[model samples]
Target: MEKWLVVLGIWAMCAACAVLFIRGATAGSDRRASVREGARAASRGSAGDTRAALND
Candidate 1:
């Protein structure tokens, strides 16, 4: 019973870490895209940029 409890705790901790890591990664990706969008907006001469921004 003690061994099972220890295993369960470890599994729970790992699951929590995985969830946090995924959320952090997605947030970073969103921030990067947002910055790119702003840059695209600033470059008013590029039609491709507009298309890419819309696709994203």
Candidate 2:
């Protein structure tokens, strides 16, 4: 029983770490996209910038 509890705790910690890492990765990508879009807008003198613009 003790061994099982320890294993479960370790697994929970690993899962939590994975979730946090994935969230961070997604947010970083979003920030990069926003920056790219902002740059394009500034370059083109457009008032509106979007993620799709960066993607293109």
Measured against the true structure, the TM-scores of the candidates, in listed sequence, are 0.74, 0.75
Local distance difference test, each candidate:
0.93, 0.89
Q: By lDDT, who's the top model here? A: 1
Tell me how many clashing residue pairs each candidate has.
0, 0
Q: After superposition on all CA atoms, what RMSD does each candidate show versus the true structure?
A: 8.7, 9.3
Superposition error at 15 for model 2 (Å): 0.3
Give me candidate 2's TM-score against the actual structure: 0.75
- Compared with the true structure, the alpha-carbon lDDT of candidate 2 equals 0.89
Task: Quote the positional error of residue 50 for candidate 1 in Å.
Answer: 18
Model 2: per-residue Cα lDDT over 1-56, one tens digit each: 99999999999999999999999999999999999998987977653455557867
Q: Residue-wise lDDT of candidate 1 within 1-56, one digit each (tens)?
A: 99999999999999999999999999999999999989988786588778989999
